[model samples]
Target: MTGYDDKPWLAAYPPGRPPHLRRAFSTALDMFDAAVRSAPDAAAIHYFDRSLRWAEVDRAAEAVASLLIARGFAPGDRLALCLQNNPAFVVGLVAAWKAGGTAVSLSPMSTEADLARSFAAFTPSALLVLDDLYVDRIRPILDTGDTGVAVVVTTSGLDGQTEDDPRIFADVDRRRPADTVDLAALVDAHLPGPGVLAALAQRRVGPSDVAVLAATSGTTGPAKGAQLTHANLAFSAQVYLDWSGLAPGEPVLGLAPVFHVTGLVGGVCLAMIAASPLVLTHRFEPAVIAAAAARRRPVFCAAVITAYIALADSPDVDAADLASLRLRYSGGAPIDPDVADRLEERLGGYIHNIYGQTETTSPSHAVPPGTRAPIDPDSGVLSVGVPVFDTVVRVIDDDGADLPVGEIGELVTTGPQVIPGYWHDPVATADAFIGGALRTGDVGFMDADGWFYVVDRKKDQINAAGYKVWPSEVERLLAGHPDVEEAAVIGIPDEYRGETVKAFVVPRPGSTLDVDAVIAYCRANLTAYKYPREVEMVAALPRTATGKVLRRALR
Candidate 1:
């Protein structure tokens, strides 16, 4: 038996924080409906100079739902959303749920090949895509008639923006396909009326029904769609709202890409649960986000650590711009403590770390508000945080047996937030879900206090001279260097050592990095066998749309 079974982390929970949600909405639609009823006139989304109220958002979603239903979109169908962080994305998500269809979150940055892979996996019946995506990706796929798509709704990414930041919308193509249905026209054609709501009620989805097919980052392998039910999404949202102590009408800055699960739940779902205004800057343009934060006074924000670093480095941003952000958080990737500290110093807020995946809907473990996560003594890695509300996290060996506290193994989790399975991939699902617990391929361990530290991905461990070295540990150490802005490590083949450590270093602006000096820095701090033997200087490391490093690309 291990301390995980006793839930030692609860002892470290913030004052008055409950181990479980007292009450949760049955579905994401119920959560959104409650927000509309509680504050119909309150701003739900802020896009540049424009703001959409809760009622307005609901009406728009209802209109879109009506359009979908009219166009033969049926219950249990898949509605793929291929757009960036815009009002249309939110509207499309709610519309899919309202129409009793699962919303498939597709990244706007996805290439044609990437889109094709997802289409084959999910077989989406409909698509609400950005005009640019429609032109480049969807149209080509539609031409081939290989997809199951029947309904196509297109929107310019600039919808709902009264004032566009040139940095974001400059040189943007607002062109729409002449034959495609316009999302805005749909909203205008069907006003806020009881007819649509009445029609939607008959097709209402239950808690267990899949609400979203959140695509995995595909860092380790081919991306699969994680089937997140309405309950999973709603519960995850409640956990975030309660854990962050977000109050009604307090703005939540949208930093994470809404297409990503972290942004979907933390940015969109959390805002609905808290009845808070979700401030959006279209996409993550540092200058635009900084200005919006300054103007909107967003109280909470959760993004990848890189976004924080970008803001800290942005010349357009000042410390006062981010002063109103009290509950700042970073997720999607691990945070280097030095980077977190530097950002906090520049931005005037403590950056809390959150850990989750597409399968978890959003967060399974998050640092409680007002508390700082402790670093692991051995690995020098910052703790991701304690297991979130009602979640069970165990570090297990290959034999499915629990490892003792402080022993590194795969992290497996089970809770309301965990997904039921991967969409349409029974074999993969079976391999991932054992009994009922999700086997997170993350290599990590839980401590005496129940604090969890993720070393690296299990597949990412490097064996140098028969010694194990986690890239994250070495990357963290390299990132601590004053000259290094970012670093990524990989295992490279070496005849003598079997495999040697290689690091790709991104130098800070105006700072020159010496490869030898960088390797020496890691050598001085880390064990000889664990330090990088080869260092490559790069302007930037390849990353996913959600900011997770693409180590495979380096290899």
Candidate 2:
């Protein structure tokens, strides 16, 4: 018997909300099929000035699926997709599933080393890369002849968009690689013939089949892949739909990166489940997103708090441009109550807090639509809302004993949305999931009324603009430099971004370390968000008697 057994949060559920899902699709593919069947002519994707109907998307996915199978992409094979929030990403995701392959989500911002580490962790059989990314990142890897990737399909970010906004697309390379197959050409072929349909029919995807290998923060080590099955994706999508009460045919704004779990499930899968149009602006350019919102009149958007802060601060974006957003949810990082209030005042919508991890597929806790999240009086931290449908959240002590209400401890959760295990890593899987519940390294507590508030992390991980940036990873990268004797990284508060990476370094005996050069070195090696934005030259990092760096002391 634990404090969570009584389910105190149910009392606060929105009127007419069910404790469990009333209905859910067996898989994401099933959900996509249902949407196409219900609204063939409804807008499925709105990219820039172009809108692709449900039927159009279905046809394109089917054609691409056929092309994939013809290229020897077998069942259970993994298809690595490195792209931004574009129409092809949507088409490629459905196509991967339809062709009986697992979709591996890879960040477009990943550097060569980052990509190499990810590839080593999960070997993909086929790769769908954006043109510029192909030229800069993928081509070099292919030249090394190390990866098992057999089929290389490339596409341009300019595909399906009639108006190429110079803010995003002006520098985009539309050139197709001579060695790789063009995704646009495959869709143009429209080869979903009887043979292709028969192939798809033979390879039926079940709920238990892995849908996406979402990457997690390599806080302990290299970024591990959380194997989110079709069931996980389907249930998580339904939770978003029901918790938010997003109406059918309403446009869902795609402000988060599609490569991320938050954007994949909340933005893409949620839109598919609701039969809503997914409004995208290539990537998350605030001015462009504001313009799209004004034109499309999108009512729902689930993005990081940083994105909301940026959108609200953009001089080009006025309240009128964002007046259409009614269901705004922010997750991936802690939200400031003052920032939320000011954003609401400026944007005219409550910034509902949604909480989850890559292991949970997307969201396990979210503020109910039309309800305001409460702030913890003692800590002044805003609650991350209560557990969603069919979820059990409990706070436990170091020995795994259940903690009383309002006592800060590690948050352990078990839900339909939680992943079964990490892909190809049994040791991590065993360590993370204990007694059928995920031992989320997050430290938080649940109030008596069932509002949950996160206080800190059990690990030394930094959440910069909702992207996980581990200090160890940054420290290791810094230690690789010739001029650095030792380094330590920490996260510092930023007015706009929720947190930014800051590094403290010790120089070699005689070597002079230029601060700008050190920062530029990290910027060149690591992803934009992972690199340290601020660097300080220090004589030594505060350490304990055991010779371990005390990050809290540095903080």
CA lDDT of each prediction against the hidden true structure? 0.88, 0.86
Runs in model 1 deviating more than 4 A are 191-195, 510-512
lDDT of 1 by residue, 4-81 (tens): 889999998988888879766899999999999999999999999999999999988898888889889989998999
Model 2 lDDT tens row, 1-555: 667999899888988888898656989999999999999998999988889999999998888778778888899988899988988889889989999989999988778999987887789988888988998888898789899888888999898886878998889869799889898888887855688788899877999999999887444346789999999999999899888888988999998888888889999999999999999877877899989999999989988777887788788888898888888999876676767898899777788999988899889888888899998887677899999999989999999999999887899999898899999889999999987799988888999999998765677767887887767557767867889877888899988789999999999879878789899999998989989999999998774221236677777
Best by lDDT: 1
Cα deviation at 399, candidate 1, in Å, is 1.9
- TM-score per candidate: 0.97, 0.84
After best superposition, candidate 1 residue 517: deviation in angstroms? 3.3
Count of clashing residue pairs in every prediction: 0, 0
